[model samples]
Target chain A: MEDVTTLTKIQLDALREVGNIGSGNAASALAQFLNRKIDMAVPTATILDFKDIPTILGGPSTLVMGIFLKVLGEISGRFLLLIPAQTSIKLLRTLIPGCEIDDPLNMGEMESSCMREVGNILAGAFLNALSALTQTPMLNSLPSMTYDMAGAMIDNVIAEMTAVSDKVLMIETSFIESEEDLKIHIFLLPEPKSLMLLLHKIGVN
Target chain B: MSVVIPVGMGELKVARSPETLVVYGIGSCIIVSLYDTKSKVGGIAHIMLPDSSGIAKERLNPNKFADTAIPALYDAIKGESGVFKANLHAKIIGGSEMFPPTEDYENNIGRDNTAAVKIALKKMGFPLIAEDTGGKRGRSIEFVLESGLIMLSILGEEPREL
Candidate 1:
C-alpha cells in the first residue's frame, strides 16, 4: 500500500487546485444565499492521520455542527461542511433573518432543516464545479445534519478508510461572510480509489 | 494523581487504578472498555470495523477490528496489569448510526459493529455489564478504573454514569 504522505508536490498542487475551483463556486452560491459578500482563504490540501482529524476541527470533544454527504457515481468520496456551534447558529440566522431569535443556540426543528438546506446548496455547488473541471459524473447522497462532538462525527466518516490507508487526503477551504464572525470550513475527503482517479485525470502518475 | 489516557481510533490503551481511560467522538465506531475490579486495571479499544477477515492484507492494528481487539485487550490487561480473565468486565459505548440506514446492510456500519462486538464478547466469555450503543447521536466516554464507573456524555444531553 502506498502512503498518501508520499504524494508528490505536483499531486498535492493538483488537489489544491480542485479545492480552489470547487470552493470558489461554493462561495458564490453562499454569497447569493446570504445576499452578502463572501471571502475565502486559499484552499489547503494535506494528508492527515486518523488522530489528526479531530485536532484540526478544534479538539476531540468540541461540539460542532456538520453536514455529511456521500458522493456516488464516478468519483466516490465524502463531503463535509463543519462550523463551530455558534457559527452554525449564525448560519441559521442568516437563512431566517426575519425571525427574532436572540440566541442561535436556542433554535428549533425549523432552524435545523434550514441548515440542512444550506448544506445541500453549498455541497451541490462545490460538486458541480468539480464535475465540470474533472469531467467526472458524480452524484451525492442526501445530506444529513448533525450537531455533535467533532471527534465522533468525523470519526464515522473516516472509519472505512482506515483499513486501506493510515493517512487521508483532506482538502479544506475556509470562508467567511461579510461583516460577520461566521466562519465555515468546506472539506472534501475523496476515497483512495477516487483520489487516484483524480490524480490520473490531472496527468500525475 | 489521576491519569487520563486517550484511546485513539484503531488504538488501545491500558491503565491502572487512579487513572481513567477515555475515548471521544464515537460515531459509528465503538469503544470497548474492559476493566478488572480485583486488579483495578482497565483497557480501552476504539474499534472501527467488525472483523479482520474482510481486510485485504495483514494489518498491524489488532485494535481496529472487534474479533482481534477483544483478545488483544484481554491479553494486555492480563499480562501487563496482572488481571485474570474472570475478573474483567466490559462496558461498550458508541456504534451510532450517524446517517440514515441504507438498503445495503453492509453499509450500515454502526449496527454491524455493535453486533460484532457482542459476538466477540460472548465468545471470549467476558460479560457485558453495561452498554450505551445504537443511537443516532455521538458519545464521549470515560472509564474510571477506581470506581468502575463509565461516564457517558452526549452532545446536548447531560453527562451520566453507567
Candidate 2:
C-alpha cells in the first residue's frame, strides 16, 4: 500500500480529485475571510521517496512557517500548512494590524494564535470537503504552529509516517492569492491503511 | 579546503582527514557522529527511527534505524581507517520534539530516538563524549573530522561546537 506503483491510474486520479475538491474549498474559505479572490493550482497527489520531501518546500535548510494538525477518526493521517517566511509575515500583518513582521523568527501570543486560528479554518474546510465527498467521519487536532527550516519542521512526521511504509502519498495543493501571488502549500498525508480505506470509500478500489 | 559530504535521511557516510560530514534539517531524527581521534577519520548516520523491530523488513534501509545503523556505521568507519576500537568516540545531536506530546502514536519520536541511540552506542562500547539534544527547534550540523568538533546550527540561534 505504500508503493505508489501498486496504485492504478484510476486510483491516482481519484486521489487527485480528492485534493481538487478539498483545496478548492479551502481556497474559497480563505478568500471569503480576506474578502478577495484566491486561486488554487490543480492539486496533485503523488507518492514520494522520503528523501525528496525536503526539496518540495525549497530545501532542508529553507526556513518557513508551518502549522501542523493530526487528523483524528477512522480515516486518520496528518495535515500541514506551509507558508514561506516572507509570505507568513505579510499575511500575519494583514490579519492583525500592528503585528510585527520585522522579525520573522519572533512571534508574540497574538500572532501565534492568529496563525493557529487561520490554520484551523483552512484545514477545517479541506477536511470537511473530504468528509462530504466520501461520507466518512473525521476531525483534526488543535493546530500547532512553528517557524523553522522546512526539513526540520516536516522530517519528524515523515519519520513516524514512513516507519510503516517507505513511501508517502502527498496530496498537495498550492493557493495563489491572485493580487500578489502569495503562495501557501497544503499537504494531506494519509496513513497507509487509511489511504486504502479512502480509495475504497471513493469507489476507486 | 575540505570537501563536505551531505548525509540525507536514512543514510550513513564515512570520511577521512580534511573531509567533513553534514546532516541538514534534523528534527526528531538523531545524528550519530563517531570519530577516531588518532586517525582523524569519522562516520555519521542520520537515523530516523529508534530501531527496526516490528517494522517490515522489505524496503527497510537498516541505516535509518538506530539499532542497526550504529553497528553498521562503526564497522564502516573502522574499515575506512583500520582504527582500533579504543580510539572511537561518539557525539549525538538533533532530537528536538517538534510537537508537544500528543496521542501515544503521535508521541515524542525525538525522545524515543535519542534514548535508542544512547542504548545502541553503549552496547557497542563507543564512549559517549558530548551531546546536544531535546529542545523544540530544528538543527543542521557539520562534523569536522580533523578536530572531532561538531558545529551545531539551529534556526534563529547562534551555532555552537559540541
Candidate 3:
C-alpha cells in the first residue's frame, strides 16, 4: 500500500544501516566457516519498481547459482544469495574442503545441496541479526538452489513480490575475497509490510 | 546492422523492421512475443505476475501481468504500427522454476504465468504458434523483427528458436 520508490533519504540510510549490520554478521560467520579473512563492502540498497528489478545482481542473463531462503514468521520476505558461475568453483572449495563444483551448470544433487547449506549459513546469520535486534522470532525455509541466468533465476521471486507490491527493496552486500577471485552478493528483500514493521522496530518511523 | 532493444521486467516494447526486441534472463517470469509476418511489427512483454486482480489500481502497469499484458501488447502493436490482430502470431517463452520442484512445488509462479498467458492469448483470439516454458533453466530471448524469430538462449545451452 505504501510507495517504496519514494523512500526518503533517512529511510534509505536506515535501510543501508540494516544491510550493514546483517551483512556484517554474515560476513563474520562466513569468514569463520572458511577460516579466512573476508572483506565485505559496505552494504547498499537498490529500490526499484518491478520494471527495473530484473536488471540488478548483474545483468539479467548472466549465468549464476542463485541460493534462496524464505524468511518466515514475525517478519517475512526472501533472502537471495547470488554466487556467480565464476565464483562457485572457488566458493565451493572453500565452503566444503575438497568439494568444489567443476561445472556449476551441471551440478549434482550433492553439489546443489552444498550450495544450499551455504545459503542457510549466510541467511541464518543475517536473519539472526534482525531477530536479535527486534526481539522477534523468525524462521527461514529450507534453502533452495538453482543454476540459471540471473534474470531467470529471479523472475519468479519478483513475480510473487509484484503480486502485492509495486517495488522491491534490495539490500545488497558484496563479500570480496580478491585473492581467490571469489565474490558473493547477498540481497535482502523484505516484503513491504514487513519492511515497514522492521523500520518501525529500528526506530526510524 | 539492425538495432537490438532490451525489454525489462514489467514492460513491453514494440518496434518495426530491422530491429530486435529482447528480454533478458527470464526465470519464473513469462515473455509474451507478438509479431506480424507481413508488417514486421514485433513486440515483446516481460510480465512478472500472472494477473493483477488484487493489485492496487494507482500503481498498476498493464505490462506487469499476463492477463493484462497480452491485450496491451496487441493494442500497442496495432496502435503504433497499424498491424491487424490477425496478422500477429503469438509466442511464449521463459517460465522457469525459481527453485527445484522438490522445494517450491506448490508455488511455481513460472507455471502459473505460462498458463495465465496462454489463457489470455486464447481469450484474445491470437493464434499461438511457439513456446518454450517450464524448466529449471533461465532464458534470454531475442525477438528479431527482420525474420520474426524468437532466439531463445539459456545458460550452458545453444540458442534455439521458439
**Order of candidate numbers by DockQ, starting with the best:** 2, 3, 1
Tell the DockQ for candidate 3.
0.65
Per residue, candidate 3 scores C-alpha lDDT tens digits across A46-147 of 777666655666677677888887888868888889898888877776666677468797677777777888889999999899888878887888888887
Candidate 1, A154-183: lDDT as tens digits: 867888877756788899999987688779
Share of native C-alpha contacts between chains A and B (below 8 angstroms) recovered by candidate 2: 0.65
lDDT of candidate 1? 0.84
Model 2 residue A127 distance off true place after TM-score fit, in angstroms: 0.1
Best candidate, TM-score-wise? 2
lDDT of 2 at B58: 78
TM-score of model 1 (CA atoms): 0.94
Candidate 3 displacement at residue A13 in angstroms: 2.4
Better of 1 and 2 by TM-score: 2
True-structure RMSD, every candidate: 1.9, 1.4, 2.1
Tell me how each candidate scores on DockQ against the true complex: 0.62, 0.69, 0.65
i-RMSD per candidate, Å? 2.0, 1.6, 1.9
Write down the lDDT of every candidate, Cα atoms only. Answer: 0.84, 0.88, 0.82
Candidate 2: clashing pairs of residues: none
Model 1, range B28-146, lDDT digits (tens) per residue? 89988888888888889889988788666664578888999989888877886468888888988989977654334337678789999999999999999999898888898888989
Off by over 4 Å in 3: A164-166, B80-82, B101-106
TM-score of each: 0.94, 0.97, 0.93
Off by over 4 Å in 2: A2-4, B102-105
Superposed Cα deviation of residue B116, candidate 1 (Å): 0.6
Worst 10 residues of 1 chain A by lDDT: A97-106
- DockQ score for candidate 1: 0.62
